[model samples]
Target: MKPHTIKYAFWGAAFGICFPLIATFFELWMSDVSLSIANVIHAHSTQPLLWIIDSAPFILGIVASFAGKKQDKLQELNTHQESIIREKTESLQKRNMILENEIELRKRISVELEAAKIEADSARQAEEKFLANMSHEIRTPLNGIVGFTRLMLDTEIDDQQQEYLQSVMRTSNHLVAIINDILELSKIKAGQIDFEMRPICSNEFFAGVMNTLILAGKDKGLSMNVSLHTSLPEAFIGDTTRLSQVLLNLINNAIKFTSKGSVTLSARMFDADFGTRLRLEVQDTGIGIPADKLESIFNDFQQAESSTTRLYGGTGLGLTISKKIIELLGGKIGVDSTLGEGSVFWVEIPCAACDRPESHAEVIRNQAEPKSLNAKILLAEDNEMNRLLAKSVFEKWTQDVEIDYAFNGKEAIEMLMEKDYDIILMDLQMPEMDGFTATRFIRTEMEAPKRDIPIIALTADVMSVERKKAFAVGMNRYITKPFKPEELISEICLCIERA
Candidate 1:
């Protein structure tokens, strides 16, 4: 104990000691007062001892005073001992309470840690499943690139020439976008993406996305729109590059599913309590998800759980990646819909993006003057007649356009690396390296602007799914097989414009 506390304890003991002494003194004082009041006289003449009779009272007072002092001292000692015991008891109680609180905190922490582990495990499993599905998805397309490019190398075709070559180039570009998405997704997840955060021009971004998909939309006869809320803060800090892709996915989904009416995209600020929040909504007057299927639509590798998989074919990763991107931006995603009526999917995020810079391409450049083929072209095709047919079309389009040969996707990539070409017309289906993989590598590996080289898809049917798929993979345009000169001319013009 500190000296001051011990001193206080001693004082308390002294007070306890003085209790008996004070009581005894009071009794003696009362007796003396009563004697004086009574005026009692002792027989003093009987004996000299009697004359000293008041001595008895004085003696009693002395005895009482000494006895009281002794008793007080003993009581002080007892009180001091009791105080020591009390202090020890309190110290132990406090220690016990502290220990109990610590144990409880530890228990709570343990429970929380276990729950976190379980969640992490589930996430890992989901990632594994997605990765597995994605790899197969990737490899399946690669075969076409390799197979078709190889075929062209061995075959010699000389007919309807140009049409077939267009298929190989178009399909290759589509494959590349798939690979690019895979790479970007990895980089973003690994925190290796050098995201340039800036205040993005919302209007410009919206317009650019629209322009990029315009041709595809036209092919499907779908109307597209972008409406921004006036309340929006004009611009916000964000990675526009990524935001564009997410918006593209949403819009493309709208276009693909909605057969009639239109696909509209809008943005508004969602009033939140603490921080800034904005909602990006994509509404499609297409095939709305059923009440039960709404939740599953965002799941990877799923498409409304129908057997008509081939009817509306897709790898089903777009929504999943979009969700991931939104989450990375610290946002929440949800959809509201009714069967047949329509559906609206929205991604709400905190408004914290930097200012945007001027976009790279204002408007796609199209072929200004259509002329005959004169330059050498690497024609990667599987069908010999298709290869010959594409060459003739290219030669016919421009006297300067030349043609080289690759039967499959792998050979096409090799040919692209070997020499330069004014344009490439890609086929969708082939063995080995597919059109998509080849196109992806060329665009991604090539420097910006040069990556803008025209790649047209030569497919059999120009369905909504096929068109979206072609654009998603970076195809300039998807021109169906047995295409007319007028149709091909328009596509060629658009391609040149984009360039």
Candidate 2:
């Protein structure tokens, strides 16, 4: 209740208690009057009436003194209660004001936090765009580095010059590989990678992976093998390129870590239930990872430890990419290792059955020869240096091979319209038009005869998704930059032969 309302209640209660005593006093006065009248009737009226008037003043005085005392006590209590009510009201008001201020402060803080979040999101988007542009910029030149390197390796040169060029070529390829892996990791982090599943011939897939892994394995003095159940399907609908990368990374990691023992890559049917779940294992007899360090290996840019990182040279992206690719393909991967005994990394995925399984397995063999770029080739590159390097590489490789150069996609289209070429080396990023748009135009606008030429992607951006994109854009082959001369030549030879 309000402060004044409480005072009113106390005052009203004091008045209510006084009413009974007031009535008693009224009755006493009436009795005294009646006796006075009675006595006056019986005796001389004038003699007794004087005594009553004289004592009346004294009786009124006594009653007034008693009422004054009672009223004083009641007023004292009212004053005390009023003081208490004032103090309590003041405290309550202060507390309420404080709470109101706190609420306002919290509201302000919440608004600031929301603003910070919005700014952070905007900054993040800008950063991503910048990184993507840089990726494209770096990739344009690298395409030429590897493409031209391959063309150069096939040329006639002194052994000493060939060896020096080989080293340069190797380093470039290595840098390109690292760049590609980083880009792939970025794509995975951004959740922009798309996976495509189709009928992948297991034997042929293993052969490709094995061919890629052998040189690295041999360099480390390591031996690698592939073992799979014969009952497995000849072809399964899955991301074969990703699966190959997954295998390639694991096997390569094995080769890197190991010094003496052979690394065996074994695959078997772990579980058949739920439609062809297979367990693929890459067991290495190398320096095994500690039990505690096993989990950290899958994290980005993280290795077993600092000491281990120094011992083994890598950006530590292979396993991270491998793990992501496996997960993208609807699977899981893990590691089992001991201190010195060995380590086994494995992945398991669901594979859909192919329509018609091939009856005979192609013989497992190694194709290490670099692709032959001696045939009439058209290189569609935007950067002048890249174009020059590519042209020089072709000129140096085969003296008589016809090489048509285009600085942009538009030039490439004109060249294509004018002359027939055996293969087209196309770059995904360009100024006038990108490879994807140009490829689409070539496929949709050109006649069947014009569109039939093999188009190989010359890029530094090599990821599972990018490869799928190359295929999507009507590219017959996708070759990452800084590639080995042998690998480049082999890819071209394969494309030309297939075409």
TM-score for all models, in order of appearance: 0.46, 0.61
Query: Given candidate 1, what's the lDDT at residue 434?
Result: 75
Q: What is the C-alpha lDDT profile of model 1 across 49-98, one tens digit per residue?
A: 43344344445454555556666677778889889988988988888998
Q: Candidate 1, overall lDDT?
A: 0.66
Stretches of model 2 off by over 4 angstroms after superposition: 1-128, 140-162, 200-208, 229-237, 272-276, 351-356, 359-380, 396-499
Cα misplacement distance, residue 288 of candidate 1 (Å): 1.4
| Deviation in Å, model 1, residue 483 alpha carbon | 26
TM-score of 2: 0.61
Which stretch of 10 consecutive residues in model 2 shows the poorest summed lDDT?
363-372
RMSD of each: 13.5, 8.8
lDDT of 2 by residue, 21-83 (tens): 444344446546543445444333434544454344455544554555566667778888999
